[model samples]
Target: MAPIRTFIAAPSNLGLKPPAPGVAPGVRHLPEHLQQFSFASRAGAVQTIYLEPPTYHGDIDPETRMRNADAIRGYSIVLAEQVQDTVRAGRQAIVLGGDCSILLGCMLGLRSQGNYGLFFLDGHTDYMWPEHSATGGVAGMDLALVTGNGHEKLTDIHHCRPYVPEQQVFCCGNRVPDESYVQLIRQSQINYYDLDALRRFGLPATAVQFLQLVETRGLDGFWVHLDVDVLHNDLMPCVDSPQPGGLSYAELRSVLLPLLSAPACKGIDITILDPTLDPDGRYASVFVDHLTGILQDAATAVL
Candidate 1:
């Protein structure tokens, strides 16, 4: 494998607001530290691309959600095109996101060439359909869309359904999954390691288990979607939905280290950082610090 090509696909339309007045100015940019891990910036082994988010307000109506979803899908299409072009040219892609929904486009882009496994780390299942959704927020429908279950436009992005078989998908760090969604997961063959399970199994061991499953399933490749809310809210409160009793910062690193080290892992999407929610920017800084370490380690391993 060649050096990793990092792309920060900032699709800010997920409707999270920036910090309110009187909040520190530096809070919003805390995650910028991630750029320091770029191989291009330091050792020149990692290439970085920062994508600007599309303009869309986060609203809760079906019409508004659909419209925003379309915009997000469109933006992802463009991003996927770039990702495909880069991978075709022989480079790995790492996408930093505006929200978890960006995974739809990132997956679409990767699957265009061949099948890829998915590792979804989030507080919620994000598998709720519009009808099942309590908030009717498109962000919650992200996983459902990618799995070919929601709005037609989202599922049909890139001219084909991008549902990697349920067996090929792994949902981790889910503390607040909907009951119906849990049933949906149980009915399907998808692998799920919720918060309690993660605590019992530990991140490295759990990650290894998933990797073994991927190998046994003969997956072509794998992508990781890490939502900051998967971390303990106290440590990473700058997300759209903050949950308690989540993974600790160290635990998160443990989970990601092995995945990042895996030869089959293709790309990553780090999402759900709401700067406005962080009063002191400490949360963003902490999350980014750990993320930067992972990127740096990945770049070193690949190099």
Candidate 2:
């Protein structure tokens, strides 16, 4: 039987620093914007689960030094519960995000089920400590937090530290050059693949290698965290942090098709696309078309 797809709406931008002082990041509107195109129906979602986040205060928490720190922690806990329920009911979850930090909740929820691997595709590495962060945005440090490298409150949720082990992680698409924190990921056990390496390795081959890592490690499943900023700036400039080099839509599809087609691939969370930036909605339309088409193709192959 084909698995039911559940659209999990996680419209929380509390993880990012305000784009302007006292102004919250506009990514909170991503879910509704995508819905304008019937994203749920087009993606074959039978049920939609919406998880509300705490209000965006745009202030750094004294305890964690990250913007809306406790709020993000609370929201993550709730999001995890929703994910656990969807998985228990034997449905595939398609998580829509307010920012990349939502990956914390998705991975935390999957941890309760069994050991899982992670395929992190983003334009930046997103690995750093709060002290190293100039803005104290969790969205930029999510990879570090998920791998159990940050504050105890966020990292040790439900006493499950390192939600997804670093060794089982495959991080790709980082194009940032000469950033100090990029070196942090390089020193970690996580398999790192930069944009240049991805092109050199070939997208299809990279996807195969990720799958092999998941299968050989005896993981129950794996989750894919795709920050749309991984798409070239010309293609997807609506992200909170747009960068220079990234995959084209065709390149993204080439890599995602194989990863999403695998039965062991549990689910994926799409994040960091800010609707406010794309006022005309043209970018959202293209993103929806490519993503839904990929989901459809993956479903067909899986069945």
Candidate 3:
């Protein structure tokens, strides 16, 4: 049977660049917005824990060369501790994020337990070095940081560099192209499948392939990183950076359901849903519906 689901809300926008000077990104409210729609109840969450994030700062930290780097680093450690505690108790964590950077904390926590694989589903690869990043926001460079591509500060947390091995990761659903970071990810050992690749190989098949890899490698488990922008911009336009093409609700369900059904799947983090863009809550409501439905369906299938 699937383990009990525990929702951890780490609503810190320190990973993202502010829209303007001294203005915090509205993405920080992601957890609260989803909870307003009763996401935890609908997803059958047994417990809900909210981590208090550090204050957001707009200035770039000289040491890390990333905006709000200091705050983000501290928050990631705190977030990691909570994730470790949740997993140690034998619960499946469904982390509600402030941005993609929270992936660091999730992975760091998993690294402490043992080696784990990653299913990184996003519209952009998010694998850029600090020098290549235009905004210097850790959100854009999360995948890189987690893979030990950046400075020691963020990557060497707990003296564990490369939280999850590059070879153990499966980066899927990236639609953006013709970028330096895209090239970077392609050169890495991570199994990369772009939007076209997903269509060519088939979504469900691709997920199964990752699962087989995890089993054969004898990983402790795997984590799922679901950035909401992976959904078609028409369907999920409330994200920070929306592009032309992405997955639809049904398409996402087809892929995510299989990953979530696996006993080896440790946790999944949902990120980048900006509530400010959906004032009437139409998009957020549908998002909640589809997500909760997928989680429920996965549980049933495993049973």
Candidate 3 lDDT over 1-303, as tens digits, reads: 756989999988888888877679998889989888999988879999999888887778888888877777788898888888888888899999889889999999999988999999999999897899889899999999999999888999989998999999999999887865588898999999999999899999999999999999999899999999999999999998989989999999999999998888889999999888888889999999999999998877842
TM-scores of all candidate predictions against the true structure: 0.85, 0.98, 0.98
lDDT, candidate 2, 1-303, per-residue tens:
455789999999988988887788899999999999899999989999888889999788888888888888999999998888888788889999999889989999999999999999999888897998998999999999999999998999999998999999989999998757588999999999999999999998998998998889889989999999999999999987777878999999999999888888778999988999998899999999999999988888842
- Residue 60, model 1: Cα distance from true site in angstroms: 5.6
Q: List the residue pairs that clash in candidate 3.
A: none
Model 1 CA lDDT for position 72: 74
Q: What is the C-alpha local distance difference test score of each model?
A: 0.67, 0.90, 0.90
Between candidates 1 and 2, the one scoring higher on lDDT is 2
Task: Candidate 2: give the clashing pairs.
Answer: none
Quote the positional error of residue 119 for candidate 1 in Å: 0.7
- Whole-structure CA lDDT of model 3: 0.90
Off by over 4 Å in 3: none
lDDT: worst 10-residue window of model 2:
294-303
Alpha-carbon error at 243 in model 1, in Å?
A: 1.8
| CA lDDT for candidate 2 | 0.90
Q: 116, model 1: CA deviation in Å?
A: 0.6
lDDT of 1 at 3: 58
